[model samples]
Target: MAEQPLLDVEQVSKSYGPRKALDGVSLQVGRGEFVALLGPNGAGKSTLFQLLSGLFVADGGSIRIGGLDLRTHMTAALARLGVVFQQPTLDLDLGVAANLRYHARLHGLGGRHARERIDAELARLGLAERAQEPARALSGGNRRKVELARALVHQPEVLLMDEATVGLDFASRRQLLDDVHALVASRGVGVLWASHLVDEAEGADRVVVLHLGHVLFTGTPAELVAHCGAADLAAAFLQLTAGGGRHAA
Candidate 1:
């Protein structure tokens, strides 16, 4: 039998008063797959991430993480998920390792097992030497790495990166992307990375394009280009979005 997808979201919807933030959205991230949720600002990317992370319940439809229904089994389903939000959440005064330890404990990890996992994740992200440094002591890019390491410390089956590379330089963004790709290759961790940058989605195993709260396309980057009959991904994105969305630099 085929194994179930690591993350499955079916026909999800959300609204703010009269404005719909998400409209019957759906996507999946399988084990070892890196799926990019590409959209410009106001395209409902963050709203979908909110649903996946349990910050907001969908107005309609269902979400399952590792096959556990998010509505009925919220705790278990959330346990299978890890996330790095666009805004920083780390305590500036907390040591790098301390922040991760706190998260690990929250997820029922502790003692030597938690330490081992934290160490492994820190080392994996090249933050081992900065373990004892206060989070405020790190640069902005390094701080993001700490958050990424913290997210993986508990070893979740699915990862959600919501505009994670926002505010990063080109090199910093590339390094972040490489680190995540390595995790996907080595640990088979499924990732749904939301971004406005077209370059970020270029290397993903699949890309789901969203615009104005609706999904516009779902396929490989090449497929998106082909489907839109454009010269390239950037052109294709502009075509699908009607050349009038807030694309970030």
Candidate 2:
């Protein structure tokens, strides 16, 4: 039998006035899986992330984290998840360690325990050397690392990364992607990294393609490539998402 999926979204739909942000989108990610969500701008990838992370409620359908329904068990569902939004959220005035401690505090950790956890997470993300530096002083890559460390302090079972590498250089982007993939492999964490970058999606355990507010396809990278008969991921993605009810390979 197949293992239970860490995340399951069924017939999820969301709209804003006349705009349909997501339309009947469904997906699954198994434990220790790194799933990349790919689509062009306005493809609804970020909208899906917002719905999953409780930033917004879907107009229809269900979202489950570890079999816990998000709509009905909001707190429990959120407790099992960590999210790194596209925007930089750290307080520039505060030191890295202080920012982490603040995050732990939000999750209800206190006293020495929170301090120890903060220190450990910083070290894990290679931010220990600059733990005392203000967030504004860190390089873009290091700041991103701090954001990731803060997200992992709670040891969440699911991680949602929305355009986390939007402005990163090639090396920084590759490093961040590798670190997140490693986390999923080593800790049985399920990750949904939303991006339009085809290269970043190539190595994912699974890929879910979205276009015009609808899910166009969901399968392994090789399966997608085969289906499109494309030389590379970008070509495959373009072919698959170009039309409604289409097959290219």
Candidate 3:
């Protein structure tokens, strides 16, 4: 039998007053797979992310992580998930290593085990040399790496990134993408990366396009390009969501 998806959102819906932020959104992220959530701003991408990562509850419908219902088994379900939000949530005054250690502690890890995991994570992120440097001293890319490492200390099976490379340079963005792909491939982790950048979605195993709070399409990058007769992801996205005028991707 095929492996079960690590993350599943079924007919999940949320609203802000009268505005429907998410209209019965459904998605799945299988083990070791990288899926991209592409949509323009205000298309409900972040709202969906919030619901999936347990930051906020969906007004309607269910969300499951590794078959555990988020509402009924929140602690158990959330334990297997890692989230990197759009903005950095690190303590700039603390060193990279210290920041990671703090995160591990917050996740219920303690004592020598936490120290070991923190050290391993910093080394894994290639920040061992800069581990002692204050986070405020690191470059934008390195800072982002620290944030990612912080999220991984618990070895979560599902990674949810919401515009993780928003302010990164082209090289940094590419590096982060490669790292994310490697994480899924080598660690058997599933990733749900939300971005408006078409280039970022190029190599995703599957792509889900959202528009006006609804999923417009869900397929491979090649399929979208082929179906829309477009040369690239950006073109395909535009063709599929052009009723409202120009879009980010």
Which candidate number would show the highest lDDT if scored against the true structure? 1
lDDT of 1 by residue, 26-133 (tens): 888999999999888999998898888999999999999999999999999999999999999999999999999999999999999999999999998888999999
- Give candidate 3 regions above 4 Å deviation: 244-249
In model 2, residue pairs whose N, Cα or C atoms come closer than 3 Å (at least 3 residues apart or on different chains), thus clashing, are none
Poorest stretch of ten by lDDT in candidate 2: 240-249
Clashing residue pairs found in predicted model 1: none
Each candidate structure's TM-score, on Cα atoms with residue i matched to residue i, is 0.96, 0.96, 0.95
- Model 1 residue runs over 4 Å out of place are 243-249
Candidate 2 matches the true fold with a TM-score of 0.96
Candidate 3: 10-residue stretch with minimal lDDT? 240-249
Put the candidates in lDDT order, highest first: 1, 3, 2
Positional deviation of residue 192's Cα in model 2 after best superposition, in angstroms: 0.4
Worst 10-residue lDDT window for candidate 1 reads 240-249
lDDT of 2 by residue, 1-249 (tens): 097788999999999999988889889988899999998898998889889999899999999998899999998989888889899999999998898888888888889988888888888777788999999999898889889989998888999999999889999999999999889878989999999999999889989988988888888899898878898788999888777662321
Which digits, one per residue and each the tens of the lDDT, describe model 3 over residues 78-178? 99999998988989999888898888887999899988888888888798899899999999999998899889999999999999999999999999899
- lDDT (CA) for every model shown? 0.91, 0.89, 0.89
Candidate 2 RMSD computed on C-alpha atoms after optimal superposition onto the true structure: 1.7
